[model samples]
Target: MPYIEECIQSILAQSFQNWRLLILDNRSTDSTDSLCSKYLADRRIEYITNATDIGMIPNFNQCLDLCDTKYYAILSHDDMYADARAVEDSLTLLENDPELCAVYSHLNWIDGNSQTIARKKFKTMGKVASDTIAKTSIRTCRNLFGVPLLVRAAAVKGHKYESAFYFTADIDFSIAIGQGLYHYVIDRPCYAIRFHASNTSMRDFSKTRSELNSIADKHRIKLSVVDSIRMRINDWQTRAGKHLFYLYLDHFRKFMPACQQR
Candidate 1:
């Protein structure tokens, strides 16, 4: 509920107050649904409570399916915009360029103290962008990290997130949309990503890699068979390093409890 509260506050504080909020509570074990209901009573907000926990892609698809707006965006319960100007700036870019199917901004990692920890993976961006933006994010926003995009609702309604991707749907969706869809990248300091050890990215690196590779291959974006093996190998090696790091803390016990034992 605290996380949802923070997210809603970010939405409410948007400098561009014209946008509406549609939240789908995917069978949260927490009280996120109740908090969303309270926000929905505001007439500007529309909220839906899911009957079961439908993983990320489907949940995102469901959210977009309900949108009647010209643009659509996904804001996870755990992340928020840095300030009111973020949306105002993004909307301005999108409005000016009808060709832009999406717009993303530079995001900074923020600690629990609300201090800048570091810039997120995708470092190159612009106020006016092109569809080619997706190719560059291949390295940084590749797998489980690329929700920083504000995409067109039509685009979202067109490509359904692969149900097979439990964690990397954003990556697959971004790739599938390809350079066919235009995107604008706002260079300003816009998104604030809260970094907590409890975040899903920290726990699901395994499934994350598989989903990423699956998407990349599906897009025919990867190189030859040997090169594809190398990419997957690199992804696995990184995850292995993280796994070994946790093992030293005697905390791997808890971390691997739910993760399937390899």
Candidate 2:
């Protein structure tokens, strides 16, 4: 609840003030209802509590059904906008370019203490024009080009998250969206993701990896031997890098004095 308030507050403090906030409480056993009620005083913020736990995918779909905006974004409760201009900047880019399907920015990973521990810089293809980028992504399958995306409501007319994929639905949906529409990367970190012990990405790491392959097969996307090997290597390297980073931090904490470390 503490973490979630920060996420909601960040939205309230956005530079782009002309926006509505929808807080869907999926039968949370916590004080989510009371907390969200506090914000009901503001006409722009709408709070809805589900009588039963409808699961994550259903909640996401409900959000889409409720949205009437030109552009919409699904924000994780554990993530927060890094700057006031995060939404404004993405919206400006999408508004200026009529052909753009969506616009998204890179994000930083923060620890439980709200301290930045790592930054993931998304590789941009400048502005994708056609299916070339999507075809390339099938073989590589490296990036899950999802979230923090200000996606055009019209572009997602027939698109919805694949409910079969409990963990890798974002990857599957990203591939689906990148099929024919044009997408753009903002080339800047505009959001912070809370990386903690309880995060789904950490809990379902193995399942997530297997689902990545399943998604490719389900879509009949073929990958060459070299491309398959490269993708595995990239995934392994990422895990190793995060492990090594934590090890270095542990060593520093043990060996260096507090003042010296500072």
Candidate 3:
């Protein structure tokens, strides 16, 4: 319940007051209902308690079904916006570009104490021209990391979230939208994922890679044999680059004066 409240407070403090927050309590046994009740005074927030616990994927679909606004994003119970201007800035970018179907920002991973653990930035993320956006998306997948994105309601009006891939549905949905309309990238880290023992991804890490492969197969978004080999080579290069960077940093730290050391 504390985590839930933190998530809600982040939304309430957004610079963009025009948005609505739909809090769906999927039959939680905790104090979630009571915690949500305290925020009813803010008309922008709406809390709905489900009679029974629907699975996670269906709950995600329900969010899509209930959305009436021009844009909507799914904020997980353990995730929150990084700042007051995240939504405002994201929506502004989407509104400014009619061709963009959605906008996602870099995400910071935080622990249960709300201290940042790591920050991940996708190499291909940023303002991309329409001509090369699809290629970039196919390559990077926007490094989704289950972070929220402000997406055009109309761009995905008829499409439904694929329930088959539990851990990789966000990637599937993003690719679906990207295949049609271009999506812009906000370079700043605007959203945060609370990484803790209870996180589903942490619990089921084994399924992620396989599920992603299944998603690509289901969507027929496969890479050619040559492209696949090139991707593998790139993966190795990226790993080696990171290894060399860390080695250099470690050597530099060891050689630094004692006064400069942490």
TM-score of each: 0.78, 0.86, 0.81
Best-to-worst order by lDDT is 2, 3, 1
Most lDDT-accurate candidate: 2
Model 1 — TM-score against the truth? Answer: 0.78
Model 3 lDDT tens row, 86-157: 889888888888888787778787766787767878555666543354333334333343354688888885
Tens digits of lDDT, candidate 2, 120-201:
8866634764355544544454454646457888877777787787776766776666666777776777888886656645
**Candidate 1 Cα outliers beyond 4 Å, as residue runs:** 112-115, 127-145, 229-262
Q: Model 3, stretches more than 4 Å misplaced?
A: 129-146, 226-262
Backbone Cα, N, C clashes tallied per candidate: 1, 0, 0
**Compared to the true structure, candidate 2 yields what TM-score?**
0.86
Put down candidate 1 lDDT per residue, 56-161, tens digits, no spaces: 6788788767878877678877788876887777777778876666777667776444556567545555533333444333433343224554676665547787
